[model samples]
Target: MRCPLARMTAETPLRYRFVGARGVRAWIAAPSVAQTQTPPRPLDPTEVETIAIIGRPSSQIAETLRRKRAAEVISDGVSAEQIGDLPAANLAEALQRVPGVAIEREVGEGQFVSVRGLGPLFQSVTLNGAPVAFNENIRNSTQSGRQFRFRALSVDLLAGARLAKSSTADMIDGGIGSNIDIETAGGLDGGPFLALRAGGEIEERTESLRPDLSIAGRIVSPDGSKGLVAGISQEDRRVRYDRFQIMRYGAFAVSGAPLTAPNDVRTTVEREDRRRRSAFLGADWRVSPNLKLDFDGLVSSFDNTIREDRLCPPSAPLRQIEGSV
Candidate 1:
């Protein structure tokens, strides 16, 4: 049975109630019930369709999960994830769990990355699918500009990171072992949100303390047609390394084995004071459904001073020269 003017009441027989074409509420009852209420105008077919669609789903990891899953399905290898979802503070530390990856650090900072057991020389890195070229002529007898310096990159502005193992024609050249692409976040990618993080660390061996901070935010237009995002991160750190070296393999030869006691080892100590910071800005405009525009830029700076003291018997008698010998 139907009711002409059903109302929200203490005892409504219908499981659900809805307003009909008229002003009267529609409901189901055992027997017909009619209430005198003014008739309403009819709803247009377009209005009914518009009211049927609901809002979109929301989740922090939704977009990243989709991309990673899509890549897994479309490509032969690799995965991707948002940087904020990573457990480590730096890209190097985060990549250690990415399987077939290794990290090398200098003075307690990740200096380089190795993939598939190959050294950094075979590994290539890029920012937003473009190789970050380095000067090979400036190599100080040690570096040949084979890989990007991980220590110089800041994780604060990272939107997402991916490890591409399978080679593709569109991928930037240079990766023999593996290719890593790091994308920065901003504008529509970040959406309308604010993120703040602060932490500190103390190294007992170094007998020093350090502080870390990061701030990021994204603002979008009322209709979400335009947006801007910006962020900054800074950290101060001190590290110390002290150890003893055997000096030479001949020191362990036969009779020299007994002469190669720990006391005969050379002693060295080094201390480094480091400061790091990263800043980024981004803009996005959805001019139309099929056309859009995006602009992003980032800069990172690292400054450090190192002091070393060494007591190696033979080398102690001579002064060491700096720069290429």
Candidate 2:
């Protein structure tokens, strides 16, 4: 039980070396064979060359055609008008020129907007793309009636407002009145723009110096992919109202006494003083070409006080009767 080993010699044929396990135990080198192919060489500078061919140039002709088409498109959908320069305080006044629009003034200032006879209460007001309808707690009291007031809304935050006469499913409903879309400076399609305004007026009767101030700005990225807009506005106004009236009353004496005067006379006087202040801020973020995010906030304060005085004749015949009765 002995294992065998293979050995090779120069005279042994390579193919017949595996006759037995002992014949395979040796190393052998194969003869070299000639190659039929050669390696590729790099191309020389003189062998490489550039070819330039010229064709008819039409860049100028194409540009002129594009400009003419653009002008036609712009003319079809937009129109231009020369509106005289107006102060910020009178912005609403300027907007009155638009068709089917109306404005209401409170204390000689534009405080309410109406579209096509629709009242302000029913219409929705928005700053940029956000609604400005925040819950406002207003308290009203009457001597004879229950104390109640409506939610007070203000348009001081708007740089401009547009009226949407037609209705769309996407827009808010319940308004038979036209929609008043307020435009704040911070939300504009154009690049960044800034504006600031401040002014005051004097009351002839009260001699009060009422003042107003506002600051607004907008910024857009150079690539038009991102933008930021912000605005803050404040207004202070004072109003005074007065009324005077005289009344005469007639009554019969209960007891048979010499009736010198059977009628009573009185004079009444009433005065009201009001002060209002409002402020607002808004922002917009264009997250993508089809999606946008917006936020807005506003605060307003109104204080009003009324004073009344009455004067009646003392010891009049009617007064004496009333006292006796």
What is the C-alpha local distance difference test score of each model? Answer: 0.70, 0.50
Residue 321's lDDT within candidate 2 is 48
> Candidate 1 at residue 138, lDDT?
24
Give the clashing pairs for model 1: none
Q: What tens-digit string does per-residue lDDT give for candidate 1 at 23-113?
A: 4444565644454354678977663444566776545357645666777322212222444455565777667766678898765667678
Lowest lDDT sum, 10 consecutive residues, model 2, at: 74-83
Instruction: Give one digit per residue, the lDDT tens place, for model 2 in 235-315.
Output: 555555554433544544646453444344665554456555556555567777888776665555656566767666653
CA deviation > 4 Å runs, candidate 1? 1-60, 72-86, 135-143, 246-265, 312-325
Work out the TM-score per prediction. Answer: 0.66, 0.50
Clash pairs (backbone) in predicted model 2: 5-22, 6-22, 6-23
